[model samples]
Target chain A: MKKESQFTPFVEKTHFWGSIFSVLAIIVLVSVPVSIMFYLNVRPEISDVLKGFWGVALIFWPTALIEICFYTPMMGAGATYLSFVSGNIANLKLPCALNAKNIVKPKKGTDEEEVVNTIAVATSAIVCTVVIAAGVLLLSPILPKITAEGSVFGPAFNQVIPALFGALLGGYLVQYWKLSILPIAAATLIVILAPTIGTGALIPICVILSIVGALLMYNNGLLTGGVKPENPLKGLVKKDK
Target chain B: MDFKESKFMYLIAFIVIAFVIGQSLFFLIRAYNHGKKIGLSAKKMKDAITASALFTIAPAVSILATVVVLASSLGTVLPWIRLTVVGNLQYEVTAAQNAMEAFAGSGKAVAFGQDITDPTVFSAVAWVMTLGVILSLVLCPLLLKKIQKKVGKVKLDSGSDNKFGDIITAATFIGLISAFVGTSLAGKASTIEENGVKQATGMGAGVMSLAVLLTSIILVVILQTLCKKFKWDKFEPFVMPISMFAGMGMAMLVYAVLPESISMLEWRPAV
Candidate 1:
């Protein structure tokens, strides 16, 4: 029998602890409001709680489920646990992991990629916590300028997501220009034509469409490797032969 | 006791923040040790840490802005803890509003900072915000392993290995970025009545956002060229933040130069 590698056991142990600590964290977090309500001798009506929850959950729960399916494969097991717990997966954790992976050039579906992702995510979580804590501590002095209506800082702050993603996306656009056009065009058309479709719904739809488009292009020999539609899924299992 | 920023709340914030920091440190050390054991270079690991830390600062500042925004309604300590933990500003704000509306009943708009004086209402907002996002935490622990296994099985059974795997990851990323880009560009052009005079408001902000995005993309292209020309591999990590800050600065200039009638940044009534 071939001896098991040291890395597999380490990953297994990390997952075990990651799950336990995540559960503990959830318990403590839930208790905060519960304890507050208990101390104040006030409980919201179940009807009110359910109504409020349904309003947000109607959009959020589906997005959360889809996000897990989409992002878990990219981020790996440890980073997924940490990223979900820390939040800001799209705007923060995902970008951080992608940047790290881009720099390291770790082969896909490997243990090394997992390590790089974990380190990047953990560092991001630490930096985010520290920065937010510092901001809270210094809130009294900086609050006025940062939050002033019509101020330059306010506009700049609002544009951070667009600005950050625009640059980050440019890199990917360059690498996969042929594969990128369809999704970009399709998403733009959808948003322009149907203003009511929120991002929560738009993302999953666009992803499915993009994957189908790429597969079709690859099959038709439009992609770099000439028409070879043996099976796109088959490519995932075979190494770089 | 009044619903003011309190010492007790700060105590809670500190405890939660400490827990998050501890958790991150634990994972960071483990990953670092694993990297070393696998014969990954010390330099590469250090570079990843440094690069991620640098990349985090700009977004972290934006998150600080979120904390400020939420603080106006949710108080200091709670927003501090919420934004630091599993809550984003958009969801938290909407959840708080929903809870307030639920408490106030139909057809009544309860302004958050002003009318959230009732402790019961405050607790309701807390519960909604907390419970609204709790599903992710529950689902992650219980289902993440299964999800990973499924993905692995897909890869194993597919046989093509890395090509299909790469396509899935790339497609997902492209889809996500495309959604954001499209949303940012899609702004309504309807007129809003102000002082019995109709004026356009949304179009200007949308244009300004596009301008900012364009500026960032140009900056990224320039940085990419320079990094390649100068062989400055060390500077690659700073490209995102540098581009972002440049775009933000351009936005400030745009905001300053635009006329009041067509201003991109609307002046809100001071809280």
Candidate 2:
């Protein structure tokens, strides 16, 4: 009984449209070089072809390739694994008394299972935040060149990003989800207030805030609220056994 | 210096090894428990174990192999970029610049796409990129199948179409914007050096790199979360684009880390 509404992202089949745009974008990008190469009509040398194969063939060795993707994807991937694990625990499934109406109420002939919609935007933000923070740190030694004079217009865009993340964060923040507001609010405040702590401090603070925010949300019973009955894995297992 | 001897290479080595070994152990145990929990067939369970292990280890294999080949070969090929017929131990330049020279000397700096019309050293680099994508596509399915066996019933693809396209789209936008921003900042930073001016700044290529790194982690954690949120489990579609974005982001970072040879950010006393 799954409708098409549940099959897409954001509003409508936006993923479909977005993917179309992405393909078009790549096509445009890839075409420019290809067109020039065609017009110039230069064939690749045998030795060059051999070299191309060699580099690609080398990637099969895990002992060497993981770091190339940057450190964030690794951690971010690990976080997904943890959340999956967390989802499996019995204690995690205990129905909250606070949301009894939402939890227990069911329409006639409707599936009685409680399914919480796992918001993609919230999780996407979480992973991106960690990875981007780490990348910034790795690049810290060489940034002065670009940032020094870059700061002129920076006076404007500096506010743009945080303001955006803040609004995005608000859209996902739920009452039963956890006191994530505390951490999100703390992070925003720190960025705005404690400019002295600088770039390096931002990561640790954000991490702490996210953790605290999650904790607060959990304590406030927002975790229960965040769970929409539509979550595929929801209520499939009984914990009291 | 050989890539093996470089700090970056060493770091990559350590991580690949750790991830392959570590994730395998954790998920293998998890697979076993999951099998026990769901009353799945022993054969299915065994398959899941193998699948999970492959999932953990395969990418490391592909990445390592790809990098090593590129590095080792690039080492040899780069000399050809500036060939010298050293007559009797005396370093003498026979040929000044060849096709590769033409490419670099063309003077139009559109880095996103380097000129391939003239087959040169840079073209060879481009070839490596072309082949890398091919290798990944060819080898990934085999690896994914092996991993599926290890995971028991778990699949990277939930077999439903969710917001994957949107996620990738957003990621690309994120990467492109970040790169452009870094480029401008780099320009302005040079301007600061020119104007004999300097000041502390809150963001720049450094922040962008940080943002990209953050974005990658966010994508990884969230990609699957996205699947769960949107109830779509097809990861390969998103991973490919994400990997591309990550690569672009990394390249920008490499550019950002260049030494201040231009004295772009150095403070100077007013005359």
Candidate 3:
């Protein structure tokens, strides 16, 4: 392989420009509907809810677009790659039956080699979704409905599904992982203390605590439970670059 | 069947049907690949199929629970707004000549139920928008594409094997059956409205069912796409967050662009 072969398409100009188109699509989408609201003299009460929903979403979509488009895809690819590595490492000491066959084993670069393959596909998917969902989310408030109701469904309830998912995750962890108590404690404490920091800060606080706690545990060489705080975001860092 | 008419009921049926049918295809593929190692048997295969089908409902139940909580919360916040305008003197709502009529008021008792803040049917319609778009945009295309590719490639093989034929046929069939179950439940949900107060008969179950049905379809789509790419060979836990946000956006788009005449069907105060 050439020395330059180590470079990835993500760092290349074409990728950057493509992502730029996605981000542009996002910005246009978020602002368009709110602008129409201004154009049409919608009622204050109704508009307030619609506008409030739009406003929060408008801010979130761009921020999330940047994360999903540029961040999560890379992270997901690398995380899965690392998972394969760790899986091998965790299985190394044992008398694995597979090794007895003396088959052609993968080189060390199997993980890194696969990184580009995974990231390219993941990033493309992320970009496609960002455009479509963003256009829908941001522009829906302005557009008319197709069905009998005259418009689309309420989305605020959609928010509940996420919280429910969190609760479900919490349930699964509490049942399966005895070590889950630590993170749960950490989460609860962070949640309670979160308000002191300010509103909309729980996620960041949880992420930081989890990351630090995991690192501390790892440095201490006591990493078996798979119950770290930064488990998800740790999956995000595409440092293979 | 008045104000609370099920808007996206048909879509729900389509989705449940798709799930049941889709299962058969997935089974055939699984049996072909892992049946030898996992111990192939018709009985075991049937058991596996049943298990997967049942397990899918766990997430569905979780979604339903979410719907209940949300519906109740919304119900609490938005109820029937009642206002009795007894005697109202002339007052111009809009400026005709800067300012038009100015008169006296006598007795006007404005009695508002919980729904005073939001007296429109935006909430109901918003859900329809959410379900409709995902069904139309996400599930339809993904299902068609996956079937075309999976089946199309098979037909090109030297000849279709027993395993190959079974996998394709079973997967599609399972998906179809699941859609039927979902749609059946939703169809049974009743709607009633009186004196400007419109609500579903079993609001919690009905709304939650829609969300669950939509989520399952989304999971199917995500699974189809991600599996082909990553080959993870399992459903994802984080699919909800992705689907929720995506579906939410779809709802918003559907609502905003809806025509005024249709949008006007939303519930309002009869003040």
What's the residue-level lDDT of A111 in candidate 3?
Answer: 31
Candidate 2: tens digits of C-alpha lDDT, residues A1-241: 8654322122122223323333332333233224324533555565644544454345322311221122112122222222221110000111110011122222211111111111111122222222222323353233333223343322222222222222122222222123333443454355334433322234334444454444344334455455422332222233213
TM of chain B, each: 0.83, 0.24, 0.26
lDDT by residue for model 3 (A1-241), tens: 6455322342232233333333332333223223323333333344423433443334333332222222122122222221111111111100011111001111212232122222222222222223223323353333223211322444323222322233223222322233233444554444333312211233333334443554455434345344433332232244323
> In model 2, which runs have C-alpha deviations exceeding 4 angstroms?
A1-34, A44-163, A174-234, A238-241, B1-119, B125-271
How well does candidate 2 score on lDDT at residue A226? 52
Number of residue pairs clashing in candidate 1, backbone atoms closer than 3 angstroms, sequence gap of 3 or more or interchain: 11
Model 2 docking category: incorrect
Report the alpha-carbon TM-score of model 3 versus the true structure. Answer: 0.30
Candidate that beats the other on lDDT, 1 or 3, i.e. the better one: 1
Ranking by TM-score: 1, 3, 2
| Deviation from native of the Cα of residue B186 in model 1, angstroms | 1.5
**Best by TM-score, which number?**
1
DockQ each candidate and list the results. Answer: 0.58, 0.05, 0.02
- Model 1 lDDT, residue A10, Cα: 67
Best by DockQ: 1
